[model samples]
Target chain A: MAKTPLDEIRSSQVWRSIFRHGYPDTERNRTLAALSNIFLHLHPVRVRKSGLGVRYTWCMGGLTFFLFLVETITGILLMFYYRPTGDAAYNDIAALRDHVPLGVMRELHRWGAHAMVVSVWLHMFRVFLTGSYKPPREFNWCVGVILLVLTLLLSFTGYLLPWDQLAIWAITVGSNMARATPFLGHEGPGASALSVHGLPLIHSSDDARFGLLAGPLVGEGALLRFYVLHCILIPFVASILMAVHFWRVRKDGGISGPM
Target chain B: MLSLLLAEGHGGGLIPAPVRSAIDRLCDPQYFLPLFFVAFVAGLVFYRKWTQPKVAGGIALAALAGFGLALTNHNFLEIVERPDNIPIVGMLGLVAFFTWYSLRLAAVNDERIEKGEGPIEKTGSNDRVLVWPDLVFSEFIALILCTVLLVVWAIAVKAPLEDPANPFKTPNPSKAPWYFLGLQEMLVYYDPWLAGVVLPGLIIVGLCAAPYIDFNPKGNGYYTFKERRFAISAFLFGFLNLWVVMVLIGTFLRGPNWNVFGPFEKWDVHKVVVLNNVNLSEGFWIGWLKTGFPAWFGASPANGSLAQAGNVIARELPGLVLVLLYLAVPPPVLASTVMKGFYKRMGFIRFNLLVFLMLSMMCLPIKMILRWTLNLKYLVAMPEWFLNI
Candidate 1:
C-alpha cells in the first residue's frame, strides 16, 4: 500500500517524537493514543460504554470544565482591556462594548459564567441521582461540593468587575452577608461578646466584611480585591481542587457503574 | 397582597382579567410556596406514574407551552426578558426538564429491578470502548457545541450593564446575583446573621456531610427511587423547593420594596404592603398578655455590665426559653417517632447531626410561616447583642 502524506508525516522523526502513537486506526494504537497524550491520559485507555452515553451523565461535568476553559480564555482577553479600578473599571467595560474590536469577549465571559453555574448544578444533580457520590467516592463528592462553591465565588467576585449599579448592588447585597459572620462580623449574633477590656473587637472597620472588602464598604479596595479573587486567588484554589477532583475520579475507579 | 392588587383595578387589557388575577393570587408567596411544595411532593410521589416517557414528555411540553403563552403578556414578558433574568428563565426550563428526565430513567431502572433485571445502565453489555474515538471525540464535539451555543447566547443577549454604581441611590429592591437570589430571599424571613451567614454556611456543610450521613448501601451506582426515597426526597425538597423556588420568587415575583408581584401584575413603585413585624417576646409579654414588657427589655443597656446583660436576658426569657425548647426538643422526638429507622441506621452522633441539619433546614419554612401568619419577626429578638433567630 502507498504511504499517504499523513502516514509519511506520522513516520517523520519530529512527528514520531511528538506523538508516541501512530494514527489511532488500529485497536493497539487507539489505546496508546489515549495513554500517550498528556491531556488524553486523564481518561483510561478504554471506558465503559454505559458511561459514555449522553443520557446517563448528561455530559454536564465535562461541559462545566469546558466552560471554565472558555471563561479563562475570554477572561484573559478581557484583562487586556479592563482596568479594575473605581475610576476606570466601568469605562473599560464601556470601551469593550463600544470601542474594542470583537467586544463579544466580555459578553462571552459573562454568559459563559452564567452557563458554568447552571452546568455545575446540573452536574451535581446528575451525580446525586446516579448515586455516584456514595461509598468510595464520598471524599470526591466533598471536593466536588467545594468546587461548586468556588464556582459561585468566582461568579460572585466577577459580578463586581463591571462596576455598574447591577454590579455594585448585587455585590453589596452578597457582601452584606459577611457582616453577619458570627463573631467575625460586627453586627452578627455573637459579635458584641467579642471584646477586649470592654472595647469591641468586632467593629465596622475590623469585622469579616471589612476583611472581605478591605474597607468599611465596597470601594476601590474591594474592586481590587474582587479583581484578584476573580482573576487570581479563587481560580487558583478552584483549579487545585479541580485537579484533585479529576485525579480522584481516575483513582477511585473512573465513571462509576454496577460493580 | 392579591386583594390589594385586585381592588386597585380590574385586571383589564392583555390576557383576560380573571386569568391574570388568578395567576396574581397564586404567585403570592404564601400560596406560591405551599403550592410549590405540593407540586414537588406530588412529583416525587407520582414519579413512577408520571415519569413514564410519554407522560413526562407531555408534561414538559405542556409546561413549555404554558410558559410560552405566559410570555405573550406584557408584564411577564418585561420581567423574563431582562438580560440578567434570562438565565433564570432558562434555569426554570432546564431544571424541570432534567429533573423529569432523571426521574424517568430512575423509574425505568426501578421497574427493571423489580422484574429481577439489572438497571438499564447495567443491562447493556459490559463491553468497553476505546477512548480515542468514542470518549475523546464526543467530549471534543460537546466542547464545540457548547462553544457555539455560548457564542450564540452571548450574541443574542448582551450582558446587562446598568448605570454606574451610585452609593447614595440604591436600586429599588436591590438584588444579589441570580444564583444567590435564594439567600437574598431568605433574608426576608431571617436575621442577616442566620440568613446571610449561618444558613449558607450550613448548606455547604450539609451538602458535604450528605454522603457520610447517608448509610444506606442500596442504589449505589444505580438509579432506584424506591430504595433511596427518603434521601432523594429530602435532597429534592432542599434543592428544588427551598433553593430554586426561592430564586424564582426573588427573580420574577419580588418587586420594589421587596414585595411580591404576580406574574401578570405591574411593578408599581407605590405598591405597598404593611410589614409591622412583632417579635415573639412582644406577642407573649405585651400583645397576648396585655401587660408591659420586663423592665430591662425596653431599657438601653448603657453600662455593658454583667448585671445589665443579665437584665436583658431576663427580659427576653420568654423568647429565650421558647427558642431553647424548639432546638432541644425535636431531635429526640424525631428519633423516637417518624425517623426511627434513620436514627437507628445513622447511630447517635450521625443521627443527631442529620436531625440538627434537617431542623436547621426546616427553620426557614417554619419562620416564614410564622411571619406570614402572625407577623412574627424574630423568635428571640436581642438587638443589644445583634442576635435574633
Candidate 2:
C-alpha cells in the first residue's frame, strides 16, 4: 500500500515527539494514549464498567470543572474590556454588553458561574448519597468541602465586579455579616470584653468587616479588593485544592464502587 | 386551549381570583416553609414506591407542567424571567431531577439487596473499560455539549446589570448571591453573628466531620437508602429542606423590605406587616412577669466597671441559663435514648461533636418558630455590649 500524506505526518519525528502513541485502536495503544497524555492521565488507564455509567455517577463533578474552565475563558475576555474601579466598572460592563463583539461572554461567564455552583452542590449530594465519602475517602471529602467553600467565595467576590446596584447591595449585605464575627467584629458578642483599661480595641475602622472590604463600607476599596480575590486569589487557591482533590481521587483507588 | 388559559390580565391567568389568593396565603413563610419541609421528608420516607421509574417520571412531569402553568401568571413570569433568577429556576428543575434519579438508583439497589443480590454497581464490577475511548470520549462529548449549552444560554438571556452602584439608595430587600440566600434567610431569625458567621462556619466543619462521625459500613460505595437511611435522610433534610428550599424562598418568595410575597402577588414597595418584635429580656421582665428591668442592667458603660459587666450578665440570666442547658444537656440524654447506637459507634468525643453540631443545626428552625409564634427578636439581647443571640 502507498503511504498516504496522513501516514507520513504520523510517521514524522515532530509528530512522533508530540504524540508518543499512534491511533489508539489496539488495546496497548489505547492504554498508551491515555497514560502518555497529561490531561487524559487524570483518568486511570481503565475503569470499572459500573463507574462508567452516567446514571451511576451523574458526571456532575466533570461538568463543574468544565464550567469553571468556561468561566475562566470568558472571564479573561471580559477583563480586557473591564476595570474594577467604581467609576469604570459599570460602564465597562455596559460597553461589553452593548458594543463589544460577542460580548455576551459576560453572560456566559455569569451563567456558567451559577451553573458551576449548582453542579458542585449536586456533586456533593451525589457523593454523599453513594457513600463515596466513607472510610478511605474521608480526607478527600474534607478537601472537597473546602473546594466547595472556595467556589462560593469565588462567585461571591465576582458578584461585585459589575459595580451595579445588585452587585454592591448584595455584597454589602454579605460583607456586613463579617462585622459580627465574634470577637473579631466591632459589634460582636465579646467585643466589649476585649477592652483594655476601659478602652475598646476592636472598632468600626479596624474590625473583621473593615479587613474584608478594605473600608467600613463596600465602596471603591471593596470593589478593588473583591476584584483581586475574584480574579486572582481565590482561583489560585481553588486550583491548588482542586489538584489535591483529583489526585486523591486516583490515590484512593479511582472512582468508588461497591466492594 | 393553552393560550386561552394563559391569557393575562388583572386576575393574572386562568386561575380564579379566590384560588390565586389562597395560594398567596399559603406561600407565606410561616405556612410554606413547614409544608415544604414535611413534603420533602414524606418523599424520602416513601422513596420506594415514589422512586419507581414510571412514578418518578410522572411526578417530575406533573411538577414541570405545574411550573409551566405558574409562569402564565404575570407576576410569577416576571420574577422567574429575571436573568439572575433564571439559574434558580434551572436549579429547581435540576435538583428535582437528580433527587428522583438518585433515589431511583437507590431503590433499585435496595430491591436487589433484598432479593439476595448485590447492588447494580457490583454486578459489573469485574468488567473494566478503557479510559482512552470510553471515558475520554464521553468527557470530550460532555465538554462540547456543556460549551454549546453555555454559549446558547449566554446569547438567549442577557446577564442582569441594574443601575450603577449608588451608596445613598439601597435596594429594598437587598439579597446576597443565590447560594448564600440560605444564610441570608437565617438572618431573619438569628443575629448576623450566629446566622452569618457562626452557622456558616459550623456548616463547613460539620460537612467535613460527617465521614468521621458516621460509623455505618453497610452502604459504602453504593446507593442503598435502606442500609444508610438515617445518614441519607439527615443529609437530604440539610441540603434540600434547610439549604435549597431556603434559597428558593429567598429568591422567589422574599420581596421588598424582605417580606414574603405570593407567587402572584405584586412586590408592593409600601407593603408592611407589623413587626412589634420584643426581645426575651423585655418579654421576661415586662411582658410576662410585669416587672421593671434591673436598673444596673441598662447601666451606661461610661464607668466601664466590672460590676456593670456582671449586671449585664445577670440581666440576661434567664436566656443565658436556658442556652447553657440546651448545649450542655443534649449529649448525655441523646446518648442514652434516641441516638444510643450513634453514641456507641461514635464514642465519647465524636458522639458529643455530632450532637453538638446537630443541636446547632436545630437552633435555626427553633429560632424561626420562636420568631413566628412570639414575634421574639432575640433570646439574649445586650445592647450595651452589642451582644445578641
Candidate 3:
C-alpha cells in the first residue's frame, strides 16, 4: 500500500510544522501541549479529574460561527441560480421554488438566515449573561456587536436580492424609515433644504434611497447593488472581522468562566 | 389628520415595467470582468504564499498575468457558453486547484518552522498549546449537521424567480414584512416620523450600545434575576409593558383603510383656525395659563356642530384621563412604600432614574394604544388634528 498524495501532503514536514506545532514528541506531552496552546485556546484547559464529566461552557459563539459558515456555503450556491435583475429576480425566485432541481438551497438560505439572526442574538445574550463582555474583552464585545449588525445588514441586503413585492415593499418601508432619521432623515433639515434649493450634497433627502440602493427605489440598479452588497461587500467585511474576532478571543485570555 | 392636510399634492412615480433578465444583465463583461481579475489575483497571492513561501513573489506576477487575461477577454460569456469552451467549469477547477495547493504549501512551511530551521519564523507563543483533535472533531460534527440540514432544505423546497416587477399596480395593504409589521403597527398610533424613524432608530442604537451603557460587571453566566437583579427586573417589566402596548395598538388602533381621518370623523377646525389666527405668543400664553381667556371662550357662544356635541364621551374622556394619569400616577408611585424599598436596595441614583424613565417611556405607547382602541371616532371626527399629524 503506497501513500496517496494527500497522505504524503499530510505527513509532509511543512504540514506537520504548521498544523501540529512541535511534534507532541510524546502522546501525553502532545495532549498537554494541546491543552496549553493559544491557538487551541477555545478548549477547556483541564478535564475534570473527578468521576463527574467535563464542564462545557455553552459554546454559543461557536454555534453562531457554525451557522455563519453554513450560510456562506448556501449563499454562494444560491448565487449560481439567483439573478439580481428587477424583472427576472422575483420570477427567478418563484421558479427556484417551483422548478429548480435543487430548490432546497433557497429554503436553506432563507431558514438559515432566520436561524443565524436568532443564533447571533442568543450568542450576544449568552456573552452578556456570562459577563464575557467585561473589562479586557469590552473592545471585543464592541467588535462582536458590530459583527452582529453586519450579520443583520447581510440579512437585510440579501432579503432584497430576491426582488419580489415582499422584498420591494419591505425595503421601501425600511429606507423610508431611514429617511426619517433626525439629522440624515429624508424629511429632516438636510432633506428639506435639498428639495428647496436643489443642492447636489450627498446628505440630500433625494439622495438617501439613491445612496443606499445606488439608484432610484427598488429597481434594476437597486437589485444589482444589493446583490453585490449581500454576496460580496458585506461578506468580505464580515469574514475579516470574524477572523479578528476569533484571534482577539485568544489575546483576551479565552472565554470568561465562573469567578 | 393634520398630516393629511399638510401632505404635498404630488403623487409618487408609478412602478415601471419589468426589465431584462438578471442573468443577461449580470453576464455583461463590464460587471464581472473586474471581479474575476480580483479573485484570480487574490488566489494567486494566497497560493504562492502557501505553496512556495520562498518564491511567493512569483505568484504576484502570475496574478498580474491573470488580470491581463481577464481584461483582454471581453466576450467572457460567449467563451463560457460555447459548446467546446466550458470556460466556467475550467475557471472553477483552476480556482480550487490553486486553493488546495496553497493550503499544502502553507502546511509544509509550518512544519519547517516547527523544526526551528526554516526561513518562516515561528512566534514563541506558537509553542503554547495545540488541541486540534477536540476542536476539529466538534467542528466536524457541527459541520456534518449543518450539511444535512442544508441538504434537507434544498430537497424539500424549490424557490423560483418571479415575474418581472410591475410597479403600476400598487397592492392594497402595501405593508412591510412580518419583522417590520411591529413598526408598521406602531405607525397607526404615532406620528410617521416617530413611528417610522425615531423609535426604531433608538431601539437599534440602544441595542448596539447595551454593553457600554450597562457596564456593571458583577454577574456573568447567571439569569437576569441573579445578576444586577434590579436592573434586569426593571428591563423585563418595561419590555413586557411596551410589548403589550404595541400589540393592543397594532390590533385595534389602525383603521381598515389606514386613514387618519374619515367622513364620520369630527373635524378639529376650531383649533386649526384659532392657531392660524392667533400668534404663537398669544396662543401659548392663553393656552398654558388658564387665565388669559380667548374672546370666544369669554363670549361662550355656541358654534354649530362643533358646539353640538362639545362634550362627547369619545372627544373629551381620553384627554381627561390622560391628563389625570400623567399628573397623578408617578408621584404617588414614587412615594409608595414599594418604590422606597426598591430605591433603598439599588444604591445608585442613576439606577433609580433609569427605572423611572423606563416606566415613564412605556406610557407614550400605552397612551397612544388607549387613544387608538377607544377613540377612533374622535380621531375620525377631528379634521387633521395636531395630534394626528
Q: Per candidate, chain B TM-score?
A: 0.92, 0.94, 0.39
TM-score of 2: 0.97
Which residue pairs in candidate 1 have backbone atoms (N, alpha carbon, C) closer than 3 angstroms, thus clashing? none
Error of 2 at A192 (Å): 1.7
Q: Is the docking of candidate 1 incorrect, acceptable, medium or high quality?
A: medium
Interface RMSD values for the candidates, listed in order? Answer: 1.2, 0.9, 10.5
* Model 2 lDDT per residue over A134-231, tens place: 97899999999999999999999999999999999999999999989999999888887788987999999999999999999999999999999999
TM-score of chain A of each: 0.97, 0.98, 0.77
Best by DockQ: 2
Indicate the DockQ of the complex predicted as candidate 1.
0.79
lDDT of 1 by residue, A1-259 (tens): 9999988887999998998877789999999998888889889987888888898889999999989999999999989888998999999888778776555788899989999999999999989988889989999999999999999999999999999999999889899999988899988888878889788888999999999999998899999999999999998999999999999998888887765
Which sequence of candidate numbers ranks them by lDDT, best first? 2, 1, 3
lDDT of 2 at A231: 92
How far does residue B70 in candidate 3 sit from its true spot (Å)?
A: 59
Q: Calculate DockQ per candidate and list them.
A: 0.79, 0.85, 0.14
Best by TM-score: 2
What is each predicted model's overall lDDT from 0 to 1?
0.88, 0.89, 0.51
- Of 2 and 3, the candidate ranking higher by lDDT: 2
